[model samples]
Target: MFFLSLVVLDPLVVVLVGLVRREGIGLAGAVMALDLCGNWWGNWHWLRDDPSQLLRLLPLTLFGVFVVASTLPLHRVVARTTARSETALPSA
Candidate 1:
């Protein structure tokens, strides 16, 4: 059920990214983090049997690494943007 939901949720996040909303970016980071953990958990047996299998999944692993590396910087940018926009609005 969880994996099945990701099928729809993943694409929805892509669309959310298109909107460039802070929530979307946050969600994307979260989804990708979950995805990486799920993939590793599912593949652990094969990876244990043949450590070389890591080579086959290196791209995915690298992408996961990149997402992990970039998420913090991206989050800060979104936060700053949100803060700026909020401050720009006139007081009620």
Candidate 2:
């Protein structure tokens, strides 16, 4: 629950951690997609039983919001921080 909200507040953490620990931001998003699907499966009782539109859309909406937030701002940061030397493949 808290983790879901934090993504809204700041998705940069997810992007950075994904880039640093995994291969890139895409993997991080894939992980989040898995989590989203898991949430739908795990919480189907409440989600299906809920009457409010907000409640129904909450979890599903979060993934798209987080993905956009994580990618848009970080695109600038990555462009600024990375150089050709850093992104280039090393000659072996």
Compute the lDDT of residue 38 as modeled in candidate 1. Answer: 84
Q: What is the number of backbone collisions in each predicted candidate, taken in the order shown?
A: 0, 0
Q: Estimate each model's TM-score.
A: 0.81, 0.45
Writing each residue's lDDT as its tens digit, candidate 2 over 1-92 gives 74566565346645666565323454456556666666667777775677464576586668666974586465656665666546685877
| Candidate 1 lDDT, 1-81, residue by residue in tens | 668989998998889878767777778888888888888888899999999988867888789889767877887897898
Which residue runs of candidate 1 sit more than 4 Å off their true CA positions? 86-92
In model 1, state the lDDT of residue 51.
100
lDDT of 2 at 87: 66
Off-target runs (Cα >4 Å) in candidate 2 are 1-22, 53-60, 63-65, 68-83, 86-92
Using lDDT, give the best candidate's number: 1
